[model samples]
Target: MALDGLDHMELEESKGGSGLRQYYLSKIEELQLTVNEKSQNLRRLQAQRNELNAKVRLLREELQLLQEQGSYVGEVVRAMDKKKVLVKVTPNCRVALRNDSYTLHKILPNKVDPLVSLMMVEKVPDSTYEMIGGLDKQIKEIKEVIELPVKHPELFEALGIAQPKVEWST
Candidate 1:
């Protein structure tokens, strides 16, 4: 009788041990799956962070270039009131006019003020001083006042004087 009882107890313990092992294995698999899912989520978030960082770096570089090249003024001009027709001056000092279609038309000028108003913007002349026959003396005087400084800037610098500016009177 004692031997039979001992054998029965051993059989029950063996069955319980097998059940515990299966349960442990299932738990480990579930934890591993959870860890894999979390890792994938972390990777996706990191990729988004990297992409945003790259975009911010590029924008900062572009802003720095604009400021360095004096094109920041153009940005300010673009930020003005939408109703006002503003003339945009490029960093290279080109005048940008708006056409009938509301498109920017870049016009190269011999000289332009960056702060010139839209009302003050004028079309480039197709005529020259020689085209006028009787204005020789007047043209010579105009050349001395205008062309002389442009042709020989050092002369004006030596004289410590700037070129004469003509102001229109109403």
Candidate 2:
């Protein structure tokens, strides 16, 4: 009976030990899985951080480029291939336009107003009158029609406020 009791006690001890080992093994596996998931999450966040950092770096570079003062300050002397130009930056130096610098050239077509100066009051140069020697009859006709109204002004009173205005042609 003593030998049987010893064998029974050993059998119970083995069962308990096996059960504890299995529980510990399962816990270790679960902990390992949790650690792996956390590590993957950390790696994903790090990668996203790296991508965002790269985009921020690009934006900073672009801002720096835009903020830089333009070195070319001159007229577009001539155009070349692919939006390039020869610019006169100074009295002596000529520069080739680079990196799509067309600010000056692009303004020329829209900025010019040829007829704007016609409203200005000006004296007719004497050299222009000296050039009209052969058109004697025509000049007399012109002086009668144009200068008569300006110099005399009594003719318009006879016509009764119907002022004669000459239209100029370009």
Candidate 3:
């Protein structure tokens, strides 16, 4: 009876050992699967991070290019604006215009006397005057009108011709 009891106890011990081994192996397999899944997730996140970084770099380059273009355009506009001419009749009375703006400058007695006295008269180019087609009659009329102002200042005042306004570029 004692020997039989001892044999049964040994059998029970072997069964328990087998069960524990199976449980431990199954737990280890589950842990390995979890570890592999986490590693895959980490790799995917790293790839996404790299793509985002590349996009940010591209955007920064584009922004820098735009800023440079903006500054260049600003410089061009400033140069264009600086090409204007400022005409001052008196110290307080001033008018500004671009060189290409007006067809002619109507000379008054006061203005002509100063220019003639200073010998600063500039002859108008025939090509410039001829560019205004159908203005022959107008030019003749303007010459006739200006003759009185040049010859007689009192007559011009009586005729009441105002100071001409300055023109700007198109």
TM-score per candidate, in order?
A: 0.36, 0.39, 0.34
The lDDT of model 2 is: 0.68
Instruction: By lDDT, rank the candidates, best first.
Output: 2, 1, 3
What lDDT does candidate 3 reach at residue 24?
A: 68
- Predictions in order: lDDT: 0.67, 0.68, 0.57
Please write out the lDDT profile of model 2 over residues 1-170, one tens digit for every residue: 45574576567568776755666688999999999999999999999999999999999999999987654445656778665666665533333234365344323222325587776659855566569779889888988888777777788889786547765433
lDDT of 3 at 38: 100
Give me the candidate number with maximum lDDT: 2
Model 2 regions more than 4 Å off: 1-14, 76-170
Highest TM-score scorer: 2
lDDT of 1: 0.67
Using TM-score, rank the candidates from best to worst: 2, 1, 3
Higher-ranked by TM-score: 2 or 3: 2
Decoy 2 TM-score against native: 0.39
Candidate number that wins on lDDT, 2 or 3: 2
Give the per-residue Cα lDDT of candidate 2 at 57: 100
Question: Between prediction 1 and prediction 3, which has the larger lDDT?
Answer: 1
All-Cα superposition RMSD per candidate: 20.6, 19.8, 22.1
Compared with the true structure, model 1 gives a TM-score of 0.36
